[model samples]
Target: MSFSIGIVGLPNVGKSTLFKALTKIKVDIAAYPFTTIHPNVGVVRVPDERLDKIAQIFKPEKITPTIIEFIDLAGLVKGAHKGEGLGNQFLAQIRNCDAILEIIRSFENPDVENVTGKIDPKNDIETIKVELELKDLEIEERNLSSPTKLLQSKSEGKEEKENLLSKKPIIYLLNTDGKTQYQVPKIKHLIMNLKDELEILELSDLEKKELGVKSKLDQLILACYNILDLITFFTVVGQKETRAWTLKNGQTAPEAGGVVHSDFQEKFIRAEVISWQKLVETGNWKKARELGQLKTVGKDYIVRDGDIIEFKI
Candidate 1:
């Protein structure tokens, strides 16, 4: 299973442009509002140095990295929660996402139209937040006989696990032009010239290096992982393959095994675990075992990031 993040914003905020840059797959991009009615889905592999190191050491025939799926939805306008501008349909597309990336326009282009007719990131953020909160409250009211007080109170809590759009962890992305200067707050934010960078992506590796351009794509993916509170683990299949997997922050070994396969979860007996760092330091698993760096853990073991696990059924 892959972690998913939904990209949201007001019209002409470069949401689809950023999506194209990230995925290298172009979707319809225009100056008009509501250009993207249906969500555009793209899968991106999670970059890990540990996976490269493991591949280098083992010379595995195949290596599979974990991935994140990005969903780009249509823009939101005022009264979105009340079914304005296809707001309800767009919001519905993002309901199952693991996190949200709210793109705010920090650049000015008279050619492109902003639905709000201004480039105030703060106001744009509040507009999206208020609409999502209203939508969540509406959903709760329709689905439950509980009082509004309980829903409101639960919504105020730090960790929102109830699939509420407003309550989900959010990372603000400032869609900027190359020369535009914008003040960013203390919250999570990323500044990018999506169209320009997307053109850079078309260049060859040698050309990119000649231009001294190091892409921030991997950094963006890692940021998404952080907001979702995800951890990566590894499993090697004999001498043929090595693969990376993701688990939630406090998930158990059995639950993690379920991510690999259903039968692995049901038949799990125990796991041989070791940190990828320790394994690298020891040169091999046999040496790590001899050095007592390898551990035998049961179903109750909480998997840590960078753990290399061998499940015994």
Candidate 2:
């Protein structure tokens, strides 16, 4: 259930700034290329309103939300696959991630250097995509050259087809200047001024609203969650803790239990399940059961988002 997202793009595209906003972990955000030679990693707790509401109802001592790790990798250039700039080092780091958040610079600043010479989001996107595709082609060719090694990988339960970097899910982040007119590429993208977001990051909610600053960091995080097709389930232990857990979509009850604990899957019997909304309306589990809102589900039951489950092991 734990996964990572690689924040990649051409240099000076605000990747590190976005990382700082998402994680509050400062790194070298120079206006030049290769500022982030080594990847900076930080774990971010996914924001969930459901978990907050559940905590308000249960009044638990501890509240735990699911998390996603973000890695700020060095920038890629036009020939990254051919050892240009940071080259394969950046691509290699990206391959290890579950998903990619590609930052496309659409902002123009005289102080900030543009690696691509001019601000063209479409061209920037193509540059990154082609590099990834070329790198994947290289990997595929290398695997074909060593048939024995390729066979070994397949025998070890690795899907050679899905191992390609281009095959991974990608979400484009258009780093805008808030007022500049830029060509928006025809792809899945979110627009935000990374510098502005960082400036307003420490301000209170009311202060942010007063300044007309709308932060899209949460939306970006949720987009990453949705891009991976993940769903969340909750567990509330009376007055002790309320926790949110992540699972892939279409997973079953036993699999959900496994997320809570490895042994819960094998020793699982049945689960006491109730929708989070129903639990909130009924005010308590005991009352929900009394009103016949709680249901018992077996291993075959597919877990739904916002489900509060009590696993029987």
| Alpha-carbon RMSD of each model | 3.6, 1.0
lDDT of 2 by residue, 128-226 (tens): 889999999998899899999899989998887777899999999999987777877888789888999898878998998788878888999999999
Error of 2 at 305 (Å): 0.7
| Per-model TM values vs. the true structure | 0.91, 0.98
True-vs-predicted CA distance for residue 234, candidate 1, Å: 0.1
lDDT of each: 0.85, 0.92
lDDT of residue 74 for candidate 1: 92
Off by over 4 Å in 2: none
Q: How many times do residue backbones clash in model 2?
A: 0
Best by lDDT: 2
Question: What pairs collide in candidate 2?
Answer: none
Model 2: worst 10 consecutive residues (lDDT sum): 179-188
Residues 198-231 of candidate 1 have per-residue lDDT tens digits of: 8788889999889887677788889998899999
